[model samples]
Target chain A: MTAKIALSDVHKSFGTKAVLRGVNLQVETGQSLVVIGGSGSGKSVMLKSILGLLTPDSGSIKIDGRETVGLARRGRADIDHQVGMLFQNGALFDSLPVWKNVAFRAIQNDGMNESDARDLAVDALKRVELGPELLDLSPAALSGGMHKRVGLARAIASKPEIIFFDEPTTGLDPIMTDVINHLIRNCVQELGSTTVTITHDMTSVRAIADKTALLYKGEIIWQGTTDELEGSDDPFLNQFINGLAHGPIEVEGQKLDSAASPIEAV
Target chain B: MTFLATIGTFFLAFFEQSGRLSVFVGQTLAAMLRPPIYFRIIGQQIIRIGYFSLPVVALTSFFTGGALAIQIYYGGNQFNSEAIVSSIVALGITRELGPVLGGLMVAGRVSAAIAAEIGTMRVTEQIDALTTLSTNPHKYLVAPRVIAATICMPVLALVADIIGIFGGFVVGTQSFGFNAAIYVQRTINFLSVDDVTSGLIKAAVFGFIIAIMGCYNGYYSKGGAQGVGRATTNAVVSASILILAANYLMTALLFSA
Candidate 1:
């Protein structure tokens, strides 16, 4: 299958600190790729680079074979219009109501009618299992789970060809996490959209990721299908997935007790 | 040697920051001229940055006008020249105090609010979210505030000019035993259209200054809450200083003859 999104030798750095040394990754059309990494492992940076929020220092990022790195506002805007992102914290506009927040891209970019946009927003929300009763509610009024649902609704509301979910289950409980994971799976299947998700939650990784990539210290050390992920023998992958502190993954260059309560196993 | 180096570094930082601010202003102006202007955001900002700032601006101008009248009278008492109070107050209110004082007061309120709100958005990734939605933050957020403040400032200054003159009038007639009709006539006669117009011009410029400073600081704010707090302070301080400095330059340019 042709690749919907492709990155080759992507490198980005801020000042002296290098975030992405050389991240070469490719997502096939209609594949869900989850990138799992530690706190400072450049997962967010990689996502931001693709979104054009942060420019890479070097390398090629191709969406449908068009090089996207360093694209100007107009050029990047055309790409952004076809892409939808669900931020780690929902990132809903507090100034707008739930409907307006969901229909933001439609009303703001396409100049769609407000009534029509709201109708579209309601349809998207319903797909996320949210009823029309929450349309008027503010983002702050919703619980963490509800917020993620609304965010999912907004992300898919525009019917984008590519959707990104950044740590979709960071703060949700187990049941809600499963709910979000299920929603993501259904959304991708229904739309047949290429999906990229960055998350550390193993349960989510299994539920959502068709293919899995492990990013550590600005490099994708291991990538394979979810079934293959279990049989992989990469030390970095083992330490991260099993929450082992003593593996090759050094914390700030200091070796810690491998037997200690592993950091952020969730 | 260390102190000398420190002084050199400080000057270099100052110039660098000033240069950055100049570029930011140019970008804001360019974005404003481009299409896809969000009229709704502009209206909301007008209410937030201009209309909401009315009470504070009015209060400061009123008090300053009355105080100016009192000070002018005291200074003129020695020469039995207190009659100049009405003329001078009207001139000062229309030409300088109206725009300058109004600008400063609004700068404190509007600049801080804009900085805090936008800075929060920046930290929370809402600004980046705007980009992902195909909306330029400059066009959607910054331009609207700048345009709203620019359009609203002259209007705010006009209101301040009237209220300030009235404050002076109240003090002159009631507090200083001046004839009300004579004071009103003198204020009307002494104040030329050019004087009010120049002040309004300054007001518009000041409005642009406030919005630019606020947006620049907030947009560039890093870190988290502490960074946002710093941006809020810098916005008020820089906008206030720029207003005072620009007022002097504009006054020289307008009335040098």
Candidate 2:
């Protein structure tokens, strides 16, 4: 069967700084593929390109065997209609109340009226363990964890065919990170939606990913199942997964003078 | 070599910006013509851009009208002081000061406001969120603001014209010892429809400039808080300058015959 999403030889750059140079990735329907990458590793850019928020310099991005690159506005919009995104910052519309934010796509695209959308929002909020009383409050009034929950609710509220989560557990504490990770896993499993989550958090990856890809230097250098991730001895993969400063992956502006170090057991 | 490179870079950047702005304008115009016009949003924006700007425009027009009267009374020949002051005040306010000053004031307020709000939205990724929601930002954000400002500015200018003339009337009758009836009559006589219409037209154009500059700057704003601050400043500055420049062009064109 054709992959739910496929990106082939995708190249993107901003001025002289190249990001996503010839990246190749694919996610099968109902599979949770976590893209592991460090900060500024083109994770967000790649996600945006997939979401049609950013155009790649050159490449093919296909959804269920259809070419998405350079699609017309209406055509691209049709693709976007089936996709939901959870941004790293939550990116909630502060001008809107929580319920409005949660119900935005439903109201705007699905043509749901206020009362119906509100009911839908309340239901979605419940799925994320949030109370209906918080619905009337602005996003600014919510704490960071609440913001992420509401964002997740908004993302899943539409029951989109595909979902992209950008660093879903980045800023949360360990417990909240665990909570978000579990919530993401549960939600995606429940929907049976194709998902590509980009993050460097090992715990999050292990928690949610069916398969994982390592993105480094604008390319997917390695990909395998979660069990294989732990067992693999690839220098770059081991270095990153173990958070080793001394490895094939250089830190700061300088490379370590030593050879690739042994992967330390966590 | 460095100096030449610097000059080349400046010209290139300027042309690049010009091209981007032209494209933005085209998109805004096209979006304005598209379906799902969001009449409700347009209405809200009208209240925000026009109704909310009334006080500043009124106050500026009033003071400008009084100042023009005083300068005319003192600067020109004192013979027929009442007629000259009243006639000149009415002409200046309706033909020039009313629209120009009012446009500048509103530009400062509205343009800065649009830039900051939209810039924040841009940085916070709310704009991207809108796209995922399948709502065109141009239609939802840009068109309503541009439409409201363009529609409301002329009305605002008309109000300014009336208040500005009143400012002159108060000064002329109360302070300058001129008869109230005579001053009113002189102003009514001197102010032709064309004069008022020209100012109103300028106001409309200025309104478009304010909203477009704000929207464009904000829509493309990058970085974070500092970038938003810069966008706000650029919006006000560009809108104010464009209003003045457009005012001059309109004045010359309107009166050339």
Candidate 3:
């Protein structure tokens, strides 16, 4: 079967700093691919490039085999309609009430009536185990965990075919992270949507990922199933998954030899 | 050689800035002319940018009118003081002061508010969310604001003109002891429809400047809270400067004869 999303040799740069350098990725339909990387490893940049929030300097980004690179906002409308994104910090419109924020895509894009949109929002919230009482409340009233839940609700509300989550469990408590991770898995399964989530949280990666990819120095260095991810002795993968201080991973412009002892490398 | 390089760099930067602004203007105009205009958003902005601004614009025009009367009476001889005060006050307020002052005040208030709101939205990635939701930020956010401010400013300036003329009338009749009827007549005789129309035109342009500057600065805001703050300040400063510059250009063009 054709991949639902395919990125090949994607390169993006900001001035002298190259964020995404020759990133190659693929996600089959109904598969959940989680990209694991350190902060500023160009994970977010890659995600943005896929979403058409940023255009790549070179290479092709295809959605359902359609070339999407260099497409203008109007050109990407059909693609955007089938995509949902949950930002790192929820990114809910603080000006809007909770229901409005959840129903924003339905009402604004789909031209659904306000009443029906509210009903859809209620249903989406329920899927995330949220009650109707939070509908009229502002996003400012929600706790951090509640914010992630609401963000997830908004992302899955329209039941788009493709969903992207950016650091979905960052800043949340352990319990909340697990809750969010499980919810993301359940939502993706329910919709049978292709998902590409970017995060460094191991617990989240194990809980949510069907296949995991390791990104380092702006490139995808490793790709495997979660079990493979855990068992693989690849220096980069081993160093990152075990939270090691050394083992061929560059730190502050210094590269640690994989054969060297962790203490000596440090 | 160093001085020449500095001058060359300045000119290049100036041209680059101008080119970017020209592109922005083109995009805004395209967004405005497109379908899905969001009339409800435009209406809300009209109330916010125009109706809410009445008090400030009116008060400024009133005090300005009164001050003009006092100055003209003191400067002129007794015989022509009443006519001179009434006529000059009416002309100045309607043709120049009313629209310019009201525009500047609205720029400070409305421009700053737009910048802060949009800047916060930018830093939070809500704009990106809007795109993901299949909505164009330019169409939904920027264009409605630009349309509303452009439509409301002329009306605001008209109100300012009337209030300002009334202020001059009160000062002329009460303080200068001139006949109220004659003061009103002289003011009416001196003020033509063209004078008011020109100021309204200036007001409309200034309104466009205010909204566009606010939207532009806020749209590109980055970093975080400090970035939002900087965007807000730049919006007000740029809008205010453009208002003054546009006013001069319009005045000279309109009254060149």
Candidate 4:
């Protein structure tokens, strides 16, 4: 399968602190890939690097086989037009009504008229099961889950060919998280678009990810199909999957002293 | 070595930030004349940046003019030239202090508020949301503010000039035993078209500086609430200092001829 997005030996640093150290990854067309990592592990930085929000210190980023590193402002905007993003916090504009927020790109960039944009926005909202009456309300009035749905609706409003989700289920209840997961899967399936999701929610990974990659210390340590993940024998993967405090990944580097020491005879 | 490096870093950051500000200004100016002008938004900003700011500017100008009249009276008495009070008062307030001081006062009040509001929106990802929805933030947010301030400050300065002159008139006629008509004639006589025009021109530039500083500081703010607060404070301080410094330079240039 041809890869739709690819990163080879990407490196980025802020000051003396290196965040992404020669990271490499690929996502094929019409597939979902989820990257899992601990906090402060550069997952967000890596996503930002791909989106051209942060410049990589070295290496290549290719979108649809076109080199995107070192792109100018206009070039980056062109790239942004081809991709949709759902930020972690929903990030809806408070000054604008919900419909306006959903229709922003279409009206501003595409030059769609107000009535047409409103119609499209309402349609997009319906896809997320939101009612037409909610269109005139501000984002601040919505609950957290509703806000995320509106954000997702706005992300897909432009009919983008590729989507990036940044920690989509960070602070949601379990049922809401599953609802979001289902919506994401249904939307991507309907569009057949390529997707890259960065998340630590294992449930989200299980429901939405076709392929999973484990990121550690700015590198992809493991990647495979979800089925392969269940049967993998790697010790690090074992410790991480079971959420164990012992094993090769120690708790603050104190070894797990076995209870089978020789002094038990007495 | 460390001190020298720190100074170098400061200069580097300053230049870098100034460059970004220039780019932002250029972008806003470019979008100002484009179609789909948000007249409603501009009207709202005019109310915020110009109309709501009147009482403070007027009050400050009034006190400043009154004080200048008293000082000139006391100082001019040394040469038995206390009769020049009206001319001196009019010249001092209209030609130099009225617009510049008024601009600085508005900068402190309006610029800081704008920076804090926009900076909070930015750190919360509202700006990103705008971009994702295909809105040009420069066009939507910054342009209305720049245009509104540019138009409003001149009007505010005009009001300040009138109020300041009236303040000088009240003190001169009531306390100094000067004839009201004579004082008004001397004040009018001393004032030239150039004086009023120069002050208005300075007001427009100061307005631009204030709005630009506010938008730049707020748009680039990071971290969150603490970062937004710092940006607001920095925007006010930097804009005020720049206005005062620019006033001196403009005065030197405008009056040199």
Candidate 5:
């Protein structure tokens, strides 16, 4: 089967610091692929590259077998229409009302009528369990969890072919995090869309991801199903998943071997 | 040799900055002429950048006109003639003070606002979101603002010129004990259509500077709140400087016979 997204040997760097040295990954159609990584592990960079937010230094990024790395603005825009992104911070347009934010793609890109767009936006919000009462309110009025829900509504509003979630559950409470994870899963299943989510949250990963890729130091170190992720005896995965102090994972450029008992996580 | 190298590096940096700004201007112009020009957004900006700015521009022109009348009266008294106050004040305001002060004031108000708003959008990744949603940020955001400001400045300057001339008339007739009919006649007779047109042209250019600087600085802003702050400051400073410089250049070009 043809992959929905194919990234091969993608290398991107900022000055001397190599963010994505050579990232190779493929996400199949209708599959939810969660990429787990530590801070600055190049997971966000990879996601941005796929979204065409950042062009790769050298490599191939194809959306449904078509090259996208150097695509023109029109070509990129054509691809962008099918892609929905829930940013790490929600990134809602503060100047716009909630309904407008949700209906942004519909109104701005598709030239849908405002009243019709608002109706569609309300419907999308309902899918995310958000009420229409909050539709007129600005994003500033919403709490963080509510903001995420609204951002989710905006993402899924147009029913795009591909969806991306960046650190979706980062700042939410445990219950809220679980809620979002389940919501993401439900949204993906309902749309039957390909998804690439970036997070280090194990609970979220286990809940939403059909397949998992562990990214460490700008490379995908492991790839398998969630069950395989849990069952694997790899010490690096063990340290990351269990939040252990001692492992093969490097902290502050110092390797803490799994055999050595570190005094503290720091 | 070290000093020469330092000078060389400065020139290189200057050229680099010029090149970047040129590219930005080209992109803005191209995006401006492209399809899907959002007239709704342009109208909204006209309200924000032009209509909302009327009060400040009008008030500034009025005060400047009053002060100019007073200054010309005193300066001309030494020559045993203060009758030129209405004529000189009308000329000064229309040809110089009206558009210049209006431009400077709008630069301070509108430029800073545009920068802060767009800079915040940049730091928040809303710009990227626009791209991902298949909307070009330049078309959706920058072009509307630039076009609105460019269209509004001449109108604002025309109003400023009238208000400024009236301010001089008020001060001349009321404060300086000049005859009302003569003051009005002297002001009207002394000013030509060229004077008003020239000021309006300068106003249009100043408007372009304000909007372009604001959009350019805001578009490239990075690194969160600190970056946004820097962009806002740069927009005002650059726009103000460019307004004054462009005013001088245009003045020399227009009226140097």
Candidate 6:
């Protein structure tokens, strides 16, 4: 299968602080790839670089077989029209009502009439299981879970072929996170859209990701199917999955207390 | 030695910041007149930046004009030449104080608000969200504000000019022993279209500068809440300084002939 998105040797830095260092990844068409990483592990930066928000110091980013690294504003807009993003925070426009926020891409970018855009917005919101009454309310009025659902509705309003979800379930309750995960799965399945989700939520990875890649420090250190992650005996994967305080990965400035404990038979 | 170095570093940083501000202003001007006007957003901002600001600008000008009449009377009384009160008040209000003070007042009120709003949006990832949705933040946010301010400030200045002249007339007639009819006539006689037009033109430029500075500072804001606060402060301070400085420059240019 041809890759829907591809990145090779991506490198980026903010002043003297390096973020992404020779990172590489690929996503096949209609596949969902979840990038798991710690905070500040450059996952967001990678997604932004793909979106042309930041020009990488060096790399090749290809979307649908076309190089997208250095696209101009018009070119970037052309690509942007084909892609949708769900930001970590809902990031809805506070000045606009929920319907307007959902239909923003349709009205502003696609040039749809107001009535048509509102209708589409209501339809999209309904798809995310939001009530029609919520459409007139401002996004500031919505709960955190509801806001994410509205953000999701907006992301899919254009029926884009590609979607990027950044930390989709970071701050939600477990039940709400599950609902979002289910919604994400169903949306991708229904639309047959390729997706890249960046999250630290392992549950979300298991629920939504077709493939899982572990980003460490600035590079993808391990990548395999979700089953592989569950079954793998890799020390890094073991330490992270098991949630052990004492392991190969050290939390800075903290002593490994278990290391001082007596050796116990496993 | 370290104190001297710190002073040098501060100047260097100031120049660097000034250079960046210039670039942002240039970009704003370039993007302002481009196609695909967002009329809805511009109308919304006109209401926010101009109509909502009317009370403050009007109040400021009225009091300033009343004060000027008193001051001019006291100064002129020294030479028994209080006859020029109406002419001086008319000239001062229409030619200088109306536009400059009105612009400064609006800048303090509107520019800081715009900067804080946009800066908060920037830090919250909302601006990035706009880009991902294929909405140009410049076209969607900044251009509308700049256009609204540019169009509305002159209207505000016109109201200010009228109110200011009325204030002077009231003060002159009541406190300074000038006949109401004579004071109004003398004020009208001293004022020309060129004087009013010059003030209006300066108001327009000041409005543009204020909005542009606010939007630019907010758009590039980083870090977090502290960063947004700094952006808001910079927006108000810079817009105020630029408005005052530009007022003088435009006055010099307009009056040179």
Winning candidate number (TM-score): 2
Q: Is 1 or 2 the stronger prediction by DockQ? A: 1
The TM-scores, one per candidate, come to: 0.96, 0.97, 0.96, 0.89, 0.96, 0.96
Superposed model 2: Cα runs more than 4 Å off? A259-266, B78-82
Question: Worst ten-residue run, lDDT, model 3 chain A?
Answer: A251-260
lDDT of 6 at B69: 94
User: How well docked is model 4, in DockQ terms?
Assistant: 0.53
Superposition error at A243 for model 1 (Å): 0.7
* Candidate lDDT (C-alpha), each: 0.92, 0.91, 0.92, 0.86, 0.92, 0.90
Q: Give fnat for candidates 1, 2 and onward, in order.
A: 0.88, 0.94, 0.97, 0.59, 0.88, 0.97
Show where candidate 4 strays beyond 4 Å.
Answer: A246-266, B1-43, B77-82, B173-179
Off by over 4 Å in 3: A252-266, B1-9, B78-80
Give me the runs in candidate 6 sitting further than 4 Å from their true place: A250-266, B1-8
Interface RMSD of each: 0.6, 0.8, 0.6, 1.9, 0.8, 0.8
Estimate the lDDT of model 4.
0.86
Best-first order by DockQ: 1, 3, 6, 2, 5, 4
The CAPRI class of candidate 2 is high
TM-score of chain B of each: 0.96, 0.98, 0.95, 0.96, 0.96, 0.95
lDDT of prediction 3 = 0.92
Cα-lDDT of candidate 6: 0.90
DockQ of candidate 3 compared with the true complex: 0.87
Indicate whether candidate 5 or candidate 6 has the larger lDDT. 5
Best by DockQ: 1
Expressed as tens digits, the lDDT of each residue in A1-266 for candidate 2 is 99999999999999999989999998999999999977777898999998888999999999989998898667887788888889888999987899999999988777799999999999999988899999899999999999999999999998989999989988899999999998998898888899999998999999999999998889999999999999999999998999877767756545653453434311
